[model samples]
Target: MFAAWWKLGFDTTLLAFEAQSVIALRMAKLAAGGTAAQAEAQRMVSEKVLAAGEAAMQLATGASHGAVVAGYRRKVRANHRRLSRGAKAI
Candidate 1:
């Protein structure tokens, strides 16, 4: 149980950091006149917002921190798998 909490915190922090990096990179490209970056940046931003809202709801309802993190992990892994197959995020 302790390990689960630790992993959740660690993973959540890492995910947030990665989201910032993605946003920065996309914004840079968009600034450089890459029109396509606009959509990509928007999508990343939306994903972050969506995840935060969902996490908040889960916590409000008394979901375990570890369970919430695991839920995100599953989604991330599913996205990873889809991308590996040359697809978009699920």
Candidate 2:
């Protein structure tokens, strides 16, 4: 139980930083102004909506705090990897 809580806290902190970087990269993509920028904006909105749906499902299912944090941590890690690779990878 203690380990779960600790891992949740650590993952949350790392996600926070990675989330910021993802947003920064997304912002830069949007600012570039092109068809790809339009796609990027749409993708961002779609992802947010999907995340909200997942959160709703988690709430309804009574998922643990650790589970919720871990889910988001995984997502942010994937996003960090994708965005870090290149603008076209994601």
Q: For each predicted model, how many residue pairs clash, with residues at least 3 apart or on different chains? A: 0, 0
Candidate 2 accuracy as lDDT: 0.80
- Report lDDT per candidate: 0.65, 0.80
> Candidate 1 lDDT, tens digit per residue, 1-90?
788767877988876665455445555555655445566567667976998899999999999887777777765655444333432321
The TM-score leader among the candidates is 2
Judge candidate 2 at residue 6 and give its lDDT: 84
TM-score of 2: 0.80
Q: After TM-score superposition, what is the CA distance of residue 13 in candidate 2 from its true location, in Å?
A: 1.1
- Candidate 2 C-alpha lDDT tens digits along 15-76: 78888989888787788889978987898789888887897799789997667777777877
**What lDDT is reached at residue 42 by model 1?**
78
